[model samples]
Target: MALTFEFETEKVIQPWRTITSLDTTLLKNWAKQRLDDAHHYNMQSNMKERLKEDVLKQYVKSSEILISVANRHCESTVSGMFKSVLFILTSAEGIVLSVSGPQELVNTLNRNHNLGPGSVFTIQNAGLNAISISIELMDWVYLTGAEHDFKLFKEWDCFCSPVRQNGEIIGYLDMSFSVQEDHLLLAGLFAFTLKSIEEELGKQDQQKSIYEHFQTYRLSPREKEIGYFWLKNYGALRIASELGLTEGTVRNVVKKIYRKTEVSDKGQFIRKFLNGLI
Candidate 1:
């Protein structure tokens, strides 16, 4: 769905950075404008039926890492803050991939609001809500109470941040709760959650690159294994213990890896093997 809003400047606004700086009046005005446009278009308040099971499975598989991290964050951090909370992870297109939180609350939302996996939250399907707005703006958004365009969501205070990988938006991470007094603080907390997920994703990407780069050395599986641990600063005794091998064996493998990679020590090995990969 196409919803347009006129801004004072052509430059894109980074809403999260400016969120604290924006006055209450200005923030309300921005939400008001979006709600007005949503009302003008007469957008649907209720979400449509979810996608097919196979299609939904594909989305879930593609976002496996994102889903894992989001759920971990919810369980370890967000769930401790409230008795009942909903964390929703959605694809770039706004189709739900996973929902994490209290089981009863998740069931209620799925049965009553059609909010389970595969449910679409785009502007066309679910009206002007946090997920839809975040996808549209490609930034962070928080909508509370009547600020929501749909009456169904008026009781929910939702905070959403677009999950980006390699500078491209891959999905959205959203946390919603019944209207509460600490909504603003919750928004900040959600931002922290997103930041952690993004940082973890970046580290994984770096590790993957390093693994692929190692392939050019033509080392055996064992050599590669020992080399990786050695490069990470693991001592021979530690690597041997972890791999269930003798320290002498691990040291021998490490020596072969160093010679094969044309490096004498860990410092040189890292400098030569991981020059541009890291």
Candidate 2:
């Protein structure tokens, strides 16, 4: 709904709708920061291009490419850039995504730090003996794993960007370096990776919005396939035709899936799907 503007229109001069002396400077800085980040952010198409075309064509087909590319790039380009070996590792809960650095760094990580295995994490390291650890970073410790990524990286002289998947922070992508370059640049890249992956995942998820958790017990292949289609809004007729089953058969199958999943209707099923508790 459009917000009704009841205030007197004192604008005739400023371009922004809401502005005050303090807000004016803040708004300008915020806009400038956004512009700067956008410049460095790999444009959507450009990011698509970053993937090997064949790979993009293959994996992104079902939208699995989001995690694939993030993990892959971390293992390949990002890792090579860091002069490290990388892995497609998940956090303790299989929620966060991470690319652990090369051999020595990995050894270091395992030996010393847990770099957080929690949801929602942060890290920063400036090369000097003097350091600034913000409350934002500290508050995140219990929220996610920071011991390894934030604390250890600070100890080893590296920087980390924690990736959040499905609203839960999963893991941190830590890079060990000798000197500080641009932490913001690295942070921005990871941010873009997260956003791109999240968008694809969100769309894929919507397609399976129905009965994700309810049907978890023991789904037959046909039941699973039928569920996939139904969540996507495919009717019995469409699903039957697509799966080479009779409409009557598809309806029977869905009833069983619902029974197994424990949900009576599509609404409850979708709620479970989004939480990922499924």
Candidate 3:
């Protein structure tokens, strides 16, 4: 996750120096405006692609495609030299788009972001602390849940940069290291990986096709039945009793079913099961 330092637009022209300006806050409003402009550019760039604003659930499983792209990038470019890298793919409102990195880190991000149901801070929220609180970090938090939000960023010593596509915020790539000077290489890696991630998400969106992409989450018979019952407004107690099962056992089964369905709560389980994550 990128911590918000400060941005200063007037200081430099070089892209490298421009990106790591310790004086990041100076660029504030103008930078935000630029992001909006970037988003407009992105929309125009992908304007030709099918838009399913009403269909595709933002960031639900974007990671499947996103992580695949990030993995290939690390293996090919860094050769695991990243040692520790975390890639978070998110939508415009800060919802996790996809995720990958060291398995442990990924798990930690997921646990903290909790990008399942009743999540606010849409994909765009990712760009909130554009210079600091990476779009990927916000989105990851929306997806996985967080031990804390943007408050603890600096303490972690991670620099966050937004990953954009055609100008729109898609996700971000992050690295955690103790030394502030390491920001140079770490920042560079974020930029490169960000590009790869953007390209991959676009390709995945094009090649897989949403319908086919989401087909991987086929629900089981038991899970389906239980889900259907729950959706019909039956609580755990009622459903379990009717099914001649103990409430605790039923609850455990429900938890497993939820995991199987990739849902954070009952509402999303029903929505995804019946309609879609979109």
| Best TM-score among the predictions, by candidate number | 1
- Stretches of candidate 2 exceeding 4 Å from the true structure: 1-73, 76-99, 112-176, 200-208, 213-220, 226-278
lDDT of 1 by residue, 1-278 (tens): 99999879687554452244546775565555443466643444455658999999999998898888777876766557655667899999999988888888788878887779999887666666788778876878877767666767777888888888778788899888889657765766677788888888887777667667677888887787787787778999999999999999998988888877787788898787667766
- Positional deviation of 82 in candidate 1, in angstroms? 4.0
Alpha-carbon deviation at 14 in model 2, angstroms? 24
Error of 1 at 249 (Å): 4.2
The sequence of per-residue lDDT tens digits that candidate 3 reaches over residues 1-278 is 98888877686333432223435564454345333444443332111122244434544455455546755775454455645544443345444344455666556544564422222222232222332344423321111112112332322345445555545665454444433345555666666765676776665453334334334656455555566577666888998888888888778878887786678898886666445322
| Number of the candidate with higher lDDT, 2 or 3 | 3
lDDT of 3 at 211: 32
lDDT of 2 at 93: 22
Clash totals, every prediction: 0, 10, 44
Task: Kindly give the stretch of ten consecutive residues in candidate 2 with the minimal lDDT sum.
Answer: 126-135
lDDT ranking of the models: 1, 3, 2
- Rank the candidate models, highest TM-score first: 1, 3, 2
Model 1 clashing-pair count: 0
Error of 3 at 132 (Å): 6.7
lDDT of 2: 0.44
